[model samples]
Target: MSIFPLDHRPDSSQISEFFQEVRCAAMEFVFPPACMMCRSEMPHRIFRTAGCTLCDDCLGQLDSGHGNACRRCGAPVGPFTIATDHCILCHRENYAFDGVIRMGLYRDSLRVACLMAKNPSGSLMSRTLADLLVDTQYELFSERAFHAVVPVPEHWAKRLIRPHYAAETMARQISARLKVRLATGILAKARWTPKQAKSPPVQRRQQQKDAFHVVGAGVQGQSILLVDDILTTGATADAAARVLKRAGASRVVVAVVAVSPPRA
Candidate 1:
């Protein structure tokens, strides 16, 4: 004889109540799960605050700076070398952007946040990241120069699949924070390209060459800020800048969450 019979079942109402009780008990047992980065109780309003244990103190300690970086590209300089204002890459080529600035390196917590923002199911954390980016960009770039926010456009197919691009979301947030107009339809992708992550740098540049087109009203003499999640070789931004300049944008400045470290 079995101690518990398969046929023996509790009433639906009782079962529901029992599960609710169990859930409450489980939550109480894990009142504050550790943060993904610092393994401490996360602060309020954080996307994964419940699951993250990181406290305010730890979050405050995160490193965020260009660190004697390139004036144009914002790439960090080496410690031993005498700090030059611009990186070698920027010096080699003239870019459409008057300048660029980034909030933090593309590592650790920022990396996790970027991944979360890309997935459709990660909307909660993605929104948090967008808020952070907007706040940071407003604080960092307001003193410089920019009249509007232009998020790099996603190709039609990608937009159809994942309509919410983090850059566009961030642009909207930044626009509100700075009280500037958000002009999203100014740039359009002419063609859908393969993922840039796996493509070699040369191929990536070539892929974006004829990819973006400027549409709608021209920016004319206004300085525009192009927002994106990451800047690898600066090719994509370069392409976008070409289109914007052709459309009469006075200037184009690139702003991103991360810029890939120099190729080895």
Candidate 2:
């Protein structure tokens, strides 16, 4: 009378075992027991320890504050007073976010890792760096309040060219840990512009002016953790925060994989 088998499904224990084996195999295949920062052979799991040899050294260096960092923008500053908490430009202007949190100083191994993460040919390294960024930022702001994860939007053209920027992946991982939803479309790029790495601070801000729009209804009265790969001028983050606030988000805090220290 019954077309279905009496014992068609596997027990929960069997399924769990199967998945565990598959996960182990996938991890070994993907990571290959190498130091994620330098690809050197790793004796132990870096993920469990927070970092391996190469990354550990770099993390230590980053904490030393060797860079001339602007207090307000988190840009590298040369000579400035922390009392103002404002770089020259920020002293004259305003930013939308409450503050910026960075994972490491951008240089040496950190710079190399960031480049790899941004490259289309560098998926494995990029994914690893993204995971690390998420973990580190979460650790730094363990006590901060956040309602959701929102990533800086790339232009549709750039998205088409580089389908997976590390920021989106990083935000998703952090959101998972925070058990909050990640909103991708809350802020969008309204213009296609050239890179801002070499642009002056004023130029950078001007270039991005009116370049973002908040889609649909506002995310009012909610705290947002805005994730990005790096913070250089703070222009991009500031622009995004402006739109997020305009759309009704209560507060915005930035989290970046790296902070390029200001040049002397």
Candidate 3:
């Protein structure tokens, strides 16, 4: 027997969707939807795309830096720089992941939005960013066939307070969009480590060394897309990639919403 009573009705889904749309219209009429990024009231917001909540201005700046980046680290480079394989910022640093794909640099509105994404309340924003990233870089991602998408796992302690973690949310979104298997729960945090942003770059690598643990098999030949919200020093990602590699993943490519700009 079909579990849903609506399953027997051919137009039930359409009816439900119609009502949902009507409800949204009513709610919007009473309380206009605001842009998630800039908090501007979108009283007459005409959605240019299905799931976008950012204002046109914010959306415009979201991808302004995607064109120029170091292929190796996904860091923004100047117009004249040759970044096909490496840029000066990343050339000397050895990262464990094969390559990187980023939506943009961590700055201005993008930085504010990424910071918002870390909170549990920013789940929708997180997924929206994920969609934007995939939509923009679908071609770049297509260059390599990923067997699975894995989010750099959250430690269990933190998951309690903020269950809607950004990395996992983005990973789930990318997995669906890219049609790759999601390797959720396969890799996990063995212990809690200080946030990479807080630690000095010198100590970052050491802190992440034994932070992650792989819990499954069948990754012997898998190519994984490792999803995260930010890439700062390449230390935490390197450590995660190291464990993923040791777990027999053939290759791991790092994908993030933004990569930290090279410090002066």
Candidate 4:
């Protein structure tokens, strides 16, 4: 016997799906889409489904950090290292976050992508990058269904200048893909801090002191996945994770598009 019943008609959800499909087709016809990366015309299937503007060649260059890495901080480590604890780069300083998952090391093509993503004009690239992150790390995300995904807060001065927050945009895509709640305004920058990229490692912790705080509630005993564009000295992530832990979050995991190699 047919479980759905012989006389069952298409429900409201089915009708909505049909209309959405028609609308997409009409929009595609009206405005032919071009690749966001190289500006090449995208295939109909690729345009409609993947929502990626990068050509296959460019997409293939997005290296995934799959080999030996510091289990805690996600920094690339020597394969022969026997230490089970934090990597050398993370050993001295304390980090509140439980773990880190980075897409790749910051260099070459990935570096260029990160630079482009920082600007509002590169919104399309940001979306494509988010898609790439989720696709590459789907298994890790699936392992623990995170209670919430939060973007590392940008300072108010920077927020005023930028039209959109790239980290938040990426976090939204990740939250959608992982089927987790997107929590914004819960954590925020308490004060403007010097850019970590320009500061020396020894001075990073002091520069980021009291830089972040929690503004929203209901996070008690929940697991959080903090999102950022790049992980450098781990200063910013550590600062934010400290505040999150104080707010009662059980576990805070860091996720970023790229991780900078340790400075010499």
lDDT score, candidate 3: 0.85
- Which prediction has more favorable TM-score, 2 or 3? 3
Better candidate by lDDT, 2 or 4: 4
**lDDT string, candidate 4, 91-209, tens digits:** 76679998888788888788888888888887777767887878877777777768999999998888998898789888988888888999987999989887667788669989887
Q: Root-mean-square deviation of each candidate, in angstroms? A: 11.4, 7.0, 4.3, 3.9
Ordered by TM-score, highest first, the candidates read 3, 4, 2, 1
Residues 1-264, candidate 3: write the lDDT tens digits.
113365465478767776776677687778988888778876453344545688788888886746677878887777787646887777788787888988988888789889899887988989989998998888889999999999999899888887699999999999999999998878899999876677888899889888998997857889999999999988888989988999899999999999887788
lDDT of 2 by residue, 93-191 (tens): 678987776656788767887887787765565556656655655655676778889988899888898857777877776677678789997788999
What is the lDDT of every predicted structure here? 0.71, 0.72, 0.85, 0.81
* Among all candidates shown, the one with the greatest lDDT: 3
Arrange candidates, best lDDT first: 3, 4, 2, 1
* Model 4 misplacement above 4 A: 1-32, 46-49, 64-66, 78-85
Runs in model 2 lying further than 4 Å from the true structure = 1-32, 44-72, 75-93, 121-124, 137-140
Q: Measured by C-alpha RMSD in angstroms, how accurate is candidate 2?
A: 7.0
TM-score of each: 0.74, 0.76, 0.90, 0.85
| Model 3 alpha-carbon drift over 4 Å, by segment | 1-15, 43-47, 65-67, 80-83
